[model samples]
Target chain A: MALLSIADALKSAIAEEMRRDPLVFCLGEDVDIPGGMGGAFTVTKGLGEEFGYERVLNTPISEIMLAGVCVGSAMMGMRPVADLQYGDFLFCMMDQLVNQAAKMCYMSGGKVHVPMVMRAPCGASNRGAQHAQSLEGFFTHVPGLKVICPSTAYDAKGLMKQAIRDDNPVLVFEHKLLYGGKRKEKDAISTIGEVPEEDYTIEFGKAAVRREGKDITIVANLLMNYKALEAAQILEQEGISCEVIDPRTLVPFDYETVVNSLKKTGRLMIVHEDNYNCGWGAQLGSWIAENQIFLLDAPIVRVATYDTPIPFSPVLENYVIPSKERIVEEARKLMKV
Target chain B: MSKLPEKERMLGMYRQMYLIRKYEERIYYLFLEGIMPGTIHQSTGQEACAVGMLYDLRKDDYMASTHRPAGHDLAKGVTLTSMMCEMFGKEDGCCRGKGGAMHTGDMEVGALVANAIVGGNMPISAGVALAFKMMKKDNVIVCFFGDGATNEGAFHESLNAAAIWKLPVIYVCENNLYSATTSIALTCNKPNPAADRAIAYDIPAEVVDGNDVLKVNEAATRAIARARTGEGPTVIELKTYRHGGHSRNDACQYRPKEEEKAWFDRDPVKNFRSYLLSQKLVAEEELQTIEKSIESDVDQAVEYAQNAPFPQIESALTDVYWEGK
Candidate 1:
């Protein structure tokens, strides 16, 4: 094992996949620009020199055109890892994703399968609301699309490979702060974890139980998984053994793991960076209340961001999004019941 | 203008136009009589624009169509039976009945199912051309759209990209004068937007009389040859008119009587048929036999669609996700 960041893990996955299949290529803004960060997160840096511009394509600032080209290419037997420089810019290509890419297979009645992956760097990082959003929930609701978010380096590499190989269109939501990307112009404190030296794959729809506990189970995704781990550490000292479950894939959700964990803890708390109302957390919370209500001894609490836009100020942003303190407090409250 | 088609080739153009006209007319009556389930955006009078361009295309070549896809789909060799079944929402439709009327197509035959959204297929067609070039194939894609589509951002962006890349694609604009109820004059200031805007992208552009199948066929042949030879994309504005309304319930009250009559006088099928007969290429008796055969074919399609089974309830969720895991 070697110390590797999320960006490096993704870059490695792209390289490995490109080597495996000649059809696999990446298309987006600044993806192949010499000396430019591989997109906004540096995941695609240096890919152009290795693969050349034809394979690692850098396109004009046309999200719709970029996505349309990817979708059209995928239909014609090419595997394209299309990216939106900023997750917020995804709105610009909503028609392409929602109307074209997602519905291509369904519209064609399974005759056509778009084997493409869309990678978007999402999360609040003191940028204004537009640059920051947990938009996976929006795509998760789309029927033909697959949504997956990987917080760790290992999962990022594995899930990305699966996405590239999968026949259907998959959307990989990577948190901006958790990328562990160091840019020439800017840098942030991030944990660059140890990635495996050998090849491995993390399956979709499997929940990784970070810390096992019997008192309460806390479920989260993306950066919230890191927050849950921190909250669990602090809660351990107070004798509150909080179990943390990181659901790698959101669309093909692993309900069995969630139900099994609920049976042990008898209480559940869902945490996410998305707004509280109608967020993916609500879907899980409602599922537990509907399907496994008998296993729950107390109510299912959800620690999510406020139903408001992410602010530019770090203080307000922290207040709006769910913090480690909020997860611990919610877990404690659920345990009391 | 000098690249005129032989008299025999011109007669073949008449057959294609005739086929699209008869197919669409049969579907329209079937839809009106409540035999077909979904709505239709018919291309009754715009047959030349569909048949003229698509007939010269190789089977491996591609075509991207607009919402009014029945004519284009038929011209591209999508069986009338499957098109009929699709209109009836049957399991045996071209798209397994999921695409309905607007999105009817068969990709195996090189047809990107018709896009319902205006200007939506523009960029997609360009990408398809890009793929063909990347694959080192001489195939070209003929992207068909309405007059109103030229005003969309996708049309401009896709055209510019195609021009720069020297992609093998033909932008066929069936300028039928109206976008739904809005006139083209109201949307675009230029009389010939497709040809006029081609100057901006530095791609050769032309305007052809869409009602005259021979004229349209000649223009399309030249354009396709240029693209095949890597001369880059060409924009052709086929000045035609839709004999029917945009959708099922539209009576086309916005069109004046004189304007409608003028277009009706120059029906593409009739004009081409007259040319074929005048040139003695096909006799009236032979033409009548062809019409009778097409009628029988359309009749069988309607019969098959009427007898076919509706998709099971489980089918709704079947193709949503490929893995279904």
Candidate 2:
């Protein structure tokens, strides 16, 4: 085991997969330029040198083309890992992603399939509205896409390998702050952890329990998971035991973990950086209502970003996005109920 | 002038072109008779473009198509029975009756489902070509689209990428003048919509008489050769026309009577048949025999589709994702 950052872990997984499979390749703007940042946050750093530029292909700033190429390649037996510079730019490739890649197999009547991985760095790092949005919620609603967010280094490498090998189009959402590599971005925080050197894979739809308790259950992902853990510590000091869960993948959501925890606590609170309107929290809350309503003793609460664009100013951005205090306060309120 | 290959090759091309012409005519009448469900963007007059572009393509070579895909699909080797069954929404249809008229294709025949969105298949073709390059295969992808697709951002972006990477893609733009009800002139000021823009991406562009199968085939052969040799992508705009309205209910009032008549006079199938006769490539009786066989084949396929059952309701829930090995 080694203390690897999420960026390094993701890079290692890509290298391992590329070495294992000849069909796996990477492409995007600045993905592997010699003197450029290998990807926006260095998730593909040093890969160009290791695998050659053919496999670590560099594309123009055409998001639609990059995404469409990935879909086109995957259907023809090439597994391409596309580096979507920012999660917000996914809109540029919406037609190819939603209408093309998502429906290719079904529309072809199982005659074709797209095996591709799209990695996008998301979360507010003082970048304005367009670059700072958490877009996992948007893709989760799209059928035929597997959306996974790995906050820790361990999960990042494991899930990335699984995503590259999986027979479906997987969207790996990485929080910018969680990428604790050498090319650290401004105002970014580190969430590095020990990662095994040997090859391994973590299955999708499995939730990681950061803190276990018999009190209210708090579920979060990406940056919000760390905030939820922080909130759990604060609430623990206040004699309010809380259970913290990190749902690794939003599409194949680990409702089982939350349900089991909710049976013990009978209370749930969802947290994320995405806005409240039609967010993943809303889906989970509704699912709980339909399937796990009996397990809850109190109404579900969601601590999320306000229904507004992520402003540039730290004061406004912090206020709009959920913080540790916000989660603790929301938990305290839910605890009372 | 590159001589016409073998008599056999010319005859095969003629047969494919005739097949597309007859199949589309059959489909047009089926829609008019209220036998086939859903709307159709029939390729009634664009027979030469499909046959010429796809005649020499190997079964392994891919051909991505637009919403108006019947001609391209048939020319690319999709079975008549499967395509007709697909039109009838039958279980054994190409797309299992899910992807109706606009989305008919069979990946096994190197024709993936046609994209309903304009220019949606351009970038996809580049990707398929990229796979062939990475896999070290000589196979190339022939992407077919319309004049309207040339204006889409996808077209520019994909062309630029394909040029930079020299991806093995032969982009075939069946320039049928009008996009639905609006004329291409209203949308793009350029005389040649697709070929003119190829200069922006540094790709070789050609404008061919789409009504002439020999000219279209010559251009396709050159483009396919360039792609196979890693010379990069080619944008070929074949100037053709649609004999009918854009879809089932279109009255085609948008088109000028003179323009429609002029295009009808140059109908691809009729002109090619005349050329074949003038060149003495085949006797009149032999051509008649081929046409007769095609008419009967289409009739039998229509009967097969009518007897074909609609897929079970539960099947709609499957194939949403393929767990292919």
Candidate 3:
């Protein structure tokens, strides 16, 4: 085992996958230049020399074209690892991802399959509204697409491998704060985690329990997962035990794990960076309320961003997104109920 | 054109055009009778464009089509029965009834199920051709679209990629003059036709008389050959017209009656039939036999679709996620 950050784990996984399969390649704007960092987040830093330009392709600054190339190349049997410098740009290529890549298989009556991976660095990073929005909720609404958000180095490496091997279009949303290295953004806090040396993969639809407790169960994704852990630590000293569950993949959601945890704890709270209305957290909250309402001590609570575009100011953006204090206060209310 | 095809080849082309015309005519009447679910974007006046471009493509090769795909699907070898069943939203349809009239195709016969969104199939066809090129397979992909699709972002992006990478794809634009109600005169300002849109990407292009089967076949043959030789993609614009309206209920009020009559005067099946008879390749009696046989074949497809069952409710839950279980 070795101590690896999320960026290192992602870079190592791409390198290994490229070596293992010649069909696997990388494509994005600024992915490879003579002395440039591989993408805005350094997930592809040293890949150009190892794989060459053909494999580590550096494309023009066109998000729509980048996604179109991935869809076209993937349809032809090449496993293209496509990236958007920021998750906010995914809106530019919505037609390609939501229309083409997602529906190709079903439209062809199972005759065709797209084995492509799209990596987008998501979540608020004080880079203002344009670059800091959490866009996973928008993608989850599209059918025939798989959405995976990895919070740790271990999950990042394994899930990236799985996304590469899977015979469908998979979107891996990596949060900016959890990247865990010297990042391009000035305000990102470091939170490195340990990853194993041996090859391993974490399958989609499996939730990892970060802390075991009994008073209440809190479920979060990406940076929210780390925030939940911090809230659990503070709640422990106040005579309340909070159980934290991180669902790595959102599309093929692990409802059984959350249901079982809810049955034991009798209290639940859902958290995400997207807005409260129509957020993925709303889907989880509704599921728990519908399927396991009797087991809950009170109504399911969801902590999410206010329904507005991400703001430019650091103070306003933090207010829009859920904070550690908000989580603690929400957990206290659930304890009361 | 191409040294006047031998008598037998000319007769074969005539028969295929006849089949498409008869098949689409049958579908139009059936749709009017409320026997088929969903609306249709019929290709009544555009038979030659489909048959001519697809006749030379092998069964292993592929074609991606648009919302108006019945003609292309039939030309690419999808059977009339399955196509009819799909139109009726039956369980045995090409897409198992998940896709209806606007999207009808059978992939086993080298046709990707028709895409309903305008210009959505362009990039996909490029990908299919890219796959064949990467695998070192001599297969080619024919991407069919309307003149309106040329304005879509996908059209430019797919063409640039296909041209730069030398992908084995033939981009065939059936410029029926209108994308629904909007005319090509309003959409494009280029001198010749939609095929010239490809020149911007530095690929070979040509504008053909879409109603003439021989002319369309010659242009597609050249493009397909260029793709097979790994030279890159070609764009062929087939200047044709559709006799029927855009969809099930449309009466085509936007077009003038005289112009519609003029196109009907030059029906592709009739033109090909006259050409064959003039060359002494087929007599009136042989042509009648072919027509009768195609009529009966379409009758059998309607019968099959009428008797086929609807898909069960469970199918809605399947094929969403492939777990490999």
**Which candidate number would show the highest lDDT if scored against the true structure?**
2
For residue A112, what is the lDDT in candidate 3?
A: 64
Q: Mark the regions of model 3 whose C-alpha exceeds 4 Å error after superposition.
A: B1-5, B191-193
**Per-model DockQ:** 0.61, 0.83, 0.43
**Of candidates 3 and 1, the better by lDDT:** 1
After TM-score superposition, what is the CA distance of residue B235 in candidate 2 from its true location, in Å?
1.2
Model 2, runs deviating above 4 Å: B1-5
Candidate 2: Cα lDDT at A100: 94
List, residue by residue over B17-40, the lDDT tens digit for candidate 1. Answer: 777787788877877788667678
lDDT (tens digit, per residue) of candidate 1 on A142-195:
888889999888888889998888988899999887888765222243657777
Q: Candidate 3's error at A80, in angstroms?
A: 2.5
All candidates in order of lDDT, best leading: 2, 1, 3
- Docking quality tier of model 2: high
Which should have the higher TM-score, number 2 or number 3? Answer: 2
Candidate 3 structure lDDT: 0.84
Candidates 1 and 2: which is better by TM-score? 2
* Model 3, residue pairs in steric clash: none
lDDT of 3 by residue, A1-337 (tens): 8788899899988889999998999978898776897888888978999888878877766566678678767866799898888988988888888888887776655656778899999988877889888888888899999999998888999999989999899999989888875665555556566778777888999999989999899999998988888999999999889889999999889998898888789999998997898889888888887888898988889999888889888889889999989999999988887
Give me the candidate number with maximum DockQ. Answer: 2
